[model samples]
Target: MHSHTNLIAVLLLTVLIHEGSAIWCYRCTSATPGCGETFNWRGIGYLGEHCPEPDDICVKLTERRGGSETITRDCLSALNFRKDIPADKYEGCRPAAKDERLAHYVNHTIKEHDVRRDYFTDTTFCFCFLDHRCNGASGMQVSAVMALLTVAAALLLR
Candidate 1:
């Protein structure tokens, strides 16, 4: 009986560790959009690279694109192109809208990684275990193991 009880406790502890580790991994290394907000990458390569956080890829790109002169020009162009900003939004000298070019620059800046979905899967796995349905069978293996332990305990106690 004592041995069976110990077995059950061990199984439960294993389950707890698995679930906790999955949740922790989901939050820590995952490169989800919300996770990207934790840093100030300025939404440049947020959807791409899977580095730690607040990567300076965008900063480097801006520096390479004619530095301050190009950045200020792009900002002025964006203000002019924005239909809702009104003509009064800019001081003078309207530059052509370079939205397409900016988008191309941003997209080409970073190599994409698939880390976000992996973390999402980890989170889903955590939820499944918590709800007692780890693999769509409703924790049948767990239940079976517990039942076997119970029966064995009863026999031993008898």
Candidate 2:
């Protein structure tokens, strides 16, 4: 009975923690270690820091050309998009707009090729709002652990 009770408490705590706040998302650039084109999820809490403010979403911008790639991770609110979409309330990735893609190619000295042929460069923007308190192996957020422990302690005392 006691073990089952503990399990139930833990489950409740997990849910509460998952929905507590935005989340401690990893913010970094390709320049930062482990945050390159191919991300290392294990480095989630090992580097970078939290978003400037809470309640914001996480964003990953990747610009690719031929064989070169650049990646950046930051809060969604911190981005400045030329054209806006329904990003504020949803989570997903989208390709850059036509004008934006043309601008990117022009600025980078690349050419946006024909649809049937090879495109020199492309830009993809990804956004997400994580609700996981403890995603095993991917690294757990500190605040989540603390909240879980606190709630467990309170439950034990009561």
Candidate 3:
């Protein structure tokens, strides 16, 4: 009985550790610019999703066109970022500033045949924690881990 209990405790600890290491982030795609309602839309809403392998960062891309901004959020594999996406578009997936949500902004101005066009983009990336809180799937993960720990403790006490 003692050895069996020890084995169970070890298995539970291993599972909890494994689950805790999994990373997740918020994902959303929008046709509208500014993304003011990105987190609050009723249809096709933002989802708390697990990051793919080697995708340790959460990325948000905001494009400004005709004085409006469109945003896309997803998980990105850090090593493949440069190889997969154009450097001119992504710039760099940096972290947001203190008290500020924007990570980086890039602007491009083109002049052609006496016509002037401007393009602007903003990129924001971060770990699961921001402003002292987890913004996405991290919350659910925490809750699950806690419940598992509670159950494990209860079983051990019995």
Candidate 4:
């Protein structure tokens, strides 16, 4: 019985570790060498940071001005430490409402947009909690590692 309990503990730890692994996100902007609209992961290398909260979602903000676009990737926790964004509310990609683009975050709420309302015409926001470094130009629908960990934990619990 004691050995069984130990085994369960190990399994639980493994599952937790796996889940935590995905809490990291690519953190950068178009200004970075390879962090533009088309991310050049190979040349610039991975520039990422871990999320402050486990439940935080990776967010990719794409702003288009006339013909040019800029991309910013980061964790919502990094974006807003004052609050937690309910994952269900922002799990996919959508056009950001005009007023929300420069909303309050604990950090980097807005740059030039804070003063100028005519910064960008089109703003795209994509959110994901799929896996490590999941934030990109688009939000991915599947979180396979999470599913696999859930199944493993369930089987172990059983």
The whole-model lDDT of each prediction reads 0.30, 0.59, 0.47, 0.68
Worst 10 residues of 3 by lDDT: 128-137
Model 2 ranges off by over 4 Å: 41-45, 80-89, 98-120, 131-158
Best by lDDT: 4
TM-score ranking from best candidate downward: 4, 2, 3, 1
lDDT of 3 by residue, 12-92 (tens): 897777566645655665563323433443344444566676325555545554567656655655324322233333424
Instruction: Give per-residue CA lDDT, model 4, range 1-158, as digits (tens).
Output: 77568777887997788785547788888888878877766545764677878687788878889899888888876666322233344567777554444344535555754443456687777887756678854224236656677678767766
- In model 1, the number of clashes is 0
Specify the poorest-scoring 10-residue window by lDDT in model 1: 55-64
Per model, state how many residue pairs clash. 0, 0, 2, 0
| Cα RMSD to the true fold for all candidates | 20.1, 7.7, 9.1, 7.1
lDDT of 1: 0.30
Q: Which candidate is the best by TM-score?
A: 4
Q: What is the TM-score of each candidate against the true structure?
A: 0.19, 0.54, 0.40, 0.61
Error of 3 at 121 (Å): 5.2
- The TM-score obtained by model 1 is 0.19
True-structure lDDT of candidate 2: 0.59
List candidate 1 segments past 4 Å from native: 23-158
What residue runs in model 4 are displaced by over 4 Å at the alpha carbon? 1-13, 20-22, 81-88, 100-116, 137-158
Q: Which of the two candidates, 3 or 4, achieves a greater TM-score against the reference?
A: 4
